[model samples]
Target: MKPRTILLSLMSYLAVTATAIAAPEYSVDHGSYNFGTVTQGKKVQHSFTIKNNGDATLQIKQLTASCGCTAATPSASSIAPGKSAEIKVVFDSTNFSGKVQKTVAMTTNAGKNPNYTFTMEGIVAEELQATPRQISLGTMKAGVPREVTVTVRNNGSTMHRLISATANSNSLQITPKIPKQNIKPGESGTVELTIASRSEARILSGYLHIVTDNPQKKEITIPIYGSAAK
Candidate 1:
């Protein structure tokens, strides 16, 4: 064969190899969605469109979300070239308040880019609000009492009352220091809690239940965790 013809053939082979290397491509119509504001105890959903813009088929192997409160589903498992599909995402606002953000990940068969992620964000409005939803007692010494306070506020236009407060463990004591039994609109009060451990080296776990007049969240449980050391 002629040297010039051999060079031409080598150039054609390189071009074909480069084209094969860039076959499958994955893309989404939008990378994020914002629900703006959502009501507490309600469920919201949104759909994101996924497109296969390459020469080969795209296969979605798995779909996952950051938390159980969020769920994602793909309309079709495989997408043909130049075709698009929908990924429906649902966010449960139950037991969630204030600003929140969640992510959904998609595992695909696209080469060099097997994982794709999208985010959803929104604000949850609640009639009643609690500060520091989870209370941490940190490390406490045995036989020593540790006191912490939690504030519950009424954010609605109507009046609400603190029906009762109780703790799962006898070692935990709860006291209400509010000026009035009923919490007026936009009013707030604190609940003082004292906990102690009997063993010198032990782990203590309990739940503090607070009952209120709010219909949606009539009762809420706060987790109490502490380690007692010498």
Candidate 2:
């Protein structure tokens, strides 16, 4: 064959190779998120769906969550023919206040559209306002009921409950009475506590756990430092 003819054939092969190779297709269900309202020092999570729209299987090369406080995970490594997968995103609300929005980036097998981005948004509230974050119970005798008042007020207008209160050990018991377990906005109440140390639980110096909507400041294991009978 002549050299001119060979050169013409080589040019035609290069043109056909470029046109025949197709790019991959990656599809994400949603691109943005809004948590509406979240409490400070709390955790929020959301799941995103991913589907394949191209002619070939979808392989996820890597994923980069928006921030260090955020986490992202997938249900599977690869998507089968005409199938789908899930991506889970979790946001940590700590040292943050008010409105917040974040994003996550994903890389796939596509040539033209190899990456996709998603988002998460929310609002955080301040710690539950109160006179003191801690309380102290003076000295007491065993088998005697000791009561104390925990002055608490909800700073926000939102309806919330103190949820539940507990003791770290069996040496004490807490009963949130008066308003009898419910307190409205700007309302005042007393959590009647009964700290009766067991005959064996002498000389008590333990803690109690208080859970509330205020995650950052929800738990207050105030010191119950005192002495019990022998």
Candidate 3:
């Protein structure tokens, strides 16, 4: 072979070798975690293992969580070829109930797959159950006061204490305050909402805010609806 031809072949081989090792590949053990059923105010955590399958190093650019209730952290920001890292995720179940889902996303420098996402899902059970979630007075006579009642049942394994019940708007007044009460497990309590008479008849819209000793749901709001007419 000619010397010039040999030189050209060597250069082509180096070019191909450089291209093979220039890109990175990212992989994970799993993409989702199921927390099953958990009580409110509980904090759940899980760790996901990440691996670099390509020849180059995988650089984690950014990590983000879907909401403030969730937090995501990485053991290491970079993973070399054939190495692994861990991504820790935590989800807070406070102020949440029923079925809930949260997510964590990460950005990387991999060529084919640069973005990855992980999910968490579970059901949150509340200890205190509120009946008649809202108050609907419909239509009332102007200058005539009325009363409304809400029942709170303890459905969990512990007792719940009722702190106070108040109105957010002056149009809907809470007269003759309801004293605090202790609700035992499997028992229920009453929260009476009294509406005061309005001198000027108009549309009424406000919320009845309730304070409780339940850590899971420290504060609850009940929408109030009604109108006064002459």
Candidate 4:
């Protein structure tokens, strides 16, 4: 090869390497956070700091949460080189119980690393808890009525009242079997639910909403699933 050609090729390679090195890069202070334990019907939030480690500006294109119960926001849409910004993630525990984990995703203009994700996890404690959480009637013949009982217990420190019980579907009926409307702390009661399908065979699915005096868990849902056979 000619000497002039080799010199030009080396110059081109150096320029490409410099441009690649100057591209924007993203670095997060932490990848995951644990909130430990939270009460139901409350909201929790955490902030994650992100730094731009490269020579170019970092442009955040979008931020998204995993579900409707979660939300995320960034402090700035763009960050200058060597600067940092914050991303806040909030989780609503109104419809969640037990252990839960949620994530927030960020899309940025960083060349090599364009996407980042942060996670938050915790356990939710409810004032009232229902056993089985869900009821499955299996396969049932059409026009036949099936019954199942769910045990409702008060897990809180104070006594609570069973205000009412309702089913979303007209084909299902709910009955509270507890002798007294008010239940002492740590006590339990039963709810009897009857599900029936009329003339047609189809999939039966509905929710049982139970109203209680517990402030945090005022309404509890019990999912019902079954198939009506012809």
Candidate 5:
């Protein structure tokens, strides 16, 4: 073989090898975790690891959770070439019940694949009522009377009575009829809440709590929301 031809072939092979090594790559050790069964009013945590096998540094541009109940913290703000990092995830199980599924997404600075995803799953007991179970009375147009209701249901088999009712503040009035004691199983009842905004609030809001046999729902405040006409 000619010396010149041999030199050319060697250069070609080097170039191909360099190209293969320069490709950017990233991966998460595990994209999912199973929490199995968790009780209500508790919390759970999991972690995922990522490695950068490419020739460039990797940056996590953003992290978003599907729900506010979940959160995360990663060890690496930016990963060095041929390096790795860890991302920790946390979930609040308060008031959530019966098979919970949540998702979290990570956005990266790597141009090729900018987004990655992960999932968490577990079962929650029905003992916790969770939040937003109550109703809110938002702003009513200045002069209009605001009448909103809070729903109370006996999802459990045990009979319960609304011996008393309450609102977060004195801005509203709530009461349960004395004669209407003992709500049977599977029965749904409403507590009439009357709120006359002493002053025009762009938004009127508060919590309504019902006293009942349900430990989960006992004194649970349901959020109320209404916006007064601007």
Candidate 6:
């Protein structure tokens, strides 16, 4: 091989290596968080550390949340090489219940993998909770009435009232007419759900919507599942 060709090949290799080393890199110390369980209408917050692991500065172009209940903000828009920044994330549990998960995405000017998503997951405990959460009316003969009861407990510090109960399907009915029941704090009350039974046997599936006086949850649903045998 000629010495000229070998020198040119070496120079090209050095140039590629230098370019790769001079690019920015985005590194997250922790990309996921689990907040366990929190009461409804509570706000939870966490901070994630981000570092620039390359020779060039890392620029955070945009930050977005998956839902309006979540908010994210970065302490610095640009991170110096080998330096760290904090990304503060907040989640509001006012409109959430049961198990929930939310995400926050970050767009950066990094050489590789510029886009990243962070996840926050946990459970939200409601102030007024039903014992079974859902009701199974069970299999019964067509045109035979069936009844099931749900116990609503007030775990909060305020009065919990069942304003009204409505069944979505005609196959079910809320007994006791209006179902107006007031539950004192740290007490419990019962709401009766009756399946009125349809003439034609088929799958029975719908939700029992319950209106509550609780501010955090104005309305709650209890899924109903059953079948009427012909």
By TM-score, the best candidate is 3
Candidate 4: 10-residue stretch with minimal lDDT = 170-179
Local accuracy of candidate 2 as per-residue lDDT tens digits, 1-230: 99999999999998778656644577777778788887667788999998877656788888798789899998886886578889888998876667888888898987678888889988876445443445555556666777676665654556556766766655655454434445566664445566665667655666656667554666545566666654
Tens digit per residue, CA lDDT, model 3, 1-230: 99999999999999999987688898889889999988778899999999999889999999899999999999999899999999999998887888999999899999998999999998987678787888788888766778778888887788888898877775666553555489898888888877864776477778877788987788778888888875
lDDT of each: 0.81, 0.70, 0.84, 0.83, 0.70, 0.85
> What is the C-alpha lDDT profile of model 4 across 16-68, one tens digit per residue?
99987888898999879999987677799999999999899999999889999
| TM-scores for every candidate against the unseen true structure | 0.61, 0.51, 0.82, 0.68, 0.51, 0.73
Worst 10 residues of 1 by lDDT: 170-179
RMSD of each: 6.7, 8.7, 2.9, 5.8, 8.5, 4.8
Return whichever of 2 and 3 wins on TM-score: 3
What root-mean-square deviation over C-alphas does model 5 reach?
A: 8.5
**Cα deviation in Å at residue 133, candidate 6?**
3.4
Error of 3 at 214 (Å): 2.7
Task: Write the residue-wise lDDT of candidate 5 on 102-185 in tens digits.
Answer: 898999877578799989897875442323465555445555565555555555556777666666643433343333547776
- What digit string (tens of lDDT, one per residue) describes model 1 on residues 65-165? 99999999999998998999999999998878889999999999898688999899989987677776887777777767777887888877788887877
Assess the local accuracy of residue 145 in candidate 2 as a C-alpha lDDT between 0 and 100.
Answer: 76
Candidate 5, residue 31: the lDDT equals 92
| lDDT: the better of candidates 2 and 6 | 6
